[model samples]
Target: MKRRNFLQQTAMAGASLFTAGQSAAATPVYQQPADNPFNLNYAMHDGMFRNSAGADIIDQIKFAYDHGFRSIEDNGMMSRTPELQKKIGDTLQKLGMNMGVFVITSDNWHWKTSLTTGKQEWIDKMMTDCKTAVDVAKRCGAKWMTVVPGNFERSLSFEYQTANVIAALRKASAVLEPHGLVMVLEMLSDNPDLFLRHSDQAYMICKAVNSPACKMLFDMYHMQRNEGDIINNIDKSWEEIGYLQIGDNPGRKEPGTGEMNYKNIFKHIHEKGYKGILGMEHGISQKGQEGEQALIKAYRDADNFL
Candidate 1:
């Protein structure tokens, strides 16, 4: 069947399920199954469905929930005001939705001088960020924050750089461990200067850190670009992976619009018993409300493998 036809049929089926006498205003704008639809806990970020949900971040979150999304992530969450963060937390708690990752950053740190430099000032700045992240996490009910080790130090040897990063992460881990929060290390494929670029590299760092609070973030889009053999590498890095993000290659848009087969990937993760969130960290393939509907349909199709 055509994608649009399938979506139209599903929408009609969902609309038919509404209770008698319930006005359209009383029903969720996005017609979805009464229960959370997807088998896996796939999370959407803020503004993903803005065309349908309007401008409010909280409304966007509630819109995602109405479409059967059980979790949400915000990379710039730390930059939000504390009052807004608490409201987000309260809203998620009330809706029984889970919060995913936010990036860990501080004013003193730069991408170039990150953990790879091994400089005390940089490490100290990271520690300060970790302390602040704890409070942010508490307010927003986030368990994991993305941590990038930053660009490589050209003057430093590979072993020295790795050691420096491990030492820095260990320190940050100590502060986060007590709070039951985790800092997930992400490997970037966008730049050659990036210190961490492979799953094995992140797995090694996580092993060396040897702290529960220090784990790797397996971003499927980056990994697909960095290494083509996705499933095998996932198994190898499974033990240390704390979070996952999703995007498709070639265009970095919704799954079906790209080359990666998300259905099989999701099935593999589900069979492996992963209860963690897989963040939908990509842009829509289409535009406006049509794009939002298409995005949800794409996930629904991919998640129907069960």
Candidate 2:
């Protein structure tokens, strides 16, 4: 497994959590000063810091950078105009920040003719999207994009479905391999109807696909719900894990709000030398700038492990 080390990514926003009885409309705007970054790269999403940065997207990026966040993820990047994408890329470059995953394809959370069907139409659709993903990657300077192979086809057997997904991924991998891009498969725990809901399943799929461009995106929140042994599961799928995401289970909010011990989890990943972007994939537990500040401090509390 390729391992990279990061400093703790939270803190200094610790003050943002407290607002004694302040209403959402009356909450005071808080400024986040750059503090020491965490050992690992915890990338903030656009809306995560909107309270501190206002409604402007570009301001959100600067606010995140102003704090300690050096990476950002935007799942909606594909929907953005090319001009906006370039502006974001340029801004990130100016700040020397890294780009993280955006979705290439997503399931409608319903039964559809997915890759699992071994349907030519589904495969063709995926191939078309793969080509588009390459162009988006280039424009945004992003290396990782999310790929969800839709829901399971009730008519198909599991083995046959697996084979179809693997075949489709190989074709997609070819499109990404030349450009040094990766498509990290996300395992969702939101629905049982979805295929690829487990970490081991993603690991097996990556192995079968056998391409560096095809890797696992271990989302801690989903995995915590699907499989509880977070550390062991991470170690099990380490090699295929090209990216990571953050969210406490139960509430799907920031760390420490739920049953999952994010402090230990963050420390474990850091000490193990797993170097990758950990996307802040959840919402803030509190409201307003206070919520955002708590989000930052929550990371600080969790990443304290050596």
Candidate of highest TM-score: 1
On residues 1-306, what C-alpha lDDT tens digit does candidate 1 reach at each position?
Answer: 211132234334333333433333334334686376588998987667665665577987888888889999887788889999999999999999999998887642435657898999888888999999999999999999989888889899999999999999999999999999999998877768889999999999999999999999998989999997899999999999999998899767788988899999999999999999999877777765667788998998999888
TM-score, cand. 2: 0.88
Per-model TM against the reference: 0.90, 0.88
Q: Cα lDDT for residue 159, model 1?
A: 94
- Across residues 1-306, which tens digit of lDDT does each residue of candidate 2 receive? 000001011222322442444335233354345666677898987667665666557887887887677899887787789988988999999998889998886333223558888888887878777788788888888999988877888888889889989999999899899999999998987667788889989999999999999999999988988988999999989989999998888977789999998888888998888778999887667766768877778887787787
Clashes by residue pair, model 2:
4-275, 6-39, 6-40, 7-38, 7-39, 8-37, 8-38, 8-39, 9-38
The CA lDDT of each predicted structure is 0.83, 0.79
Model 1 worst lDDT run, 10 consecutive residues: 1-10
Q: In each prediction, how many residue pairs overlap at the backbone (N, C-alpha, C within less than 3 A)?
A: 0, 9
Score residue 232 of candidate 1 by CA lDDT: 95
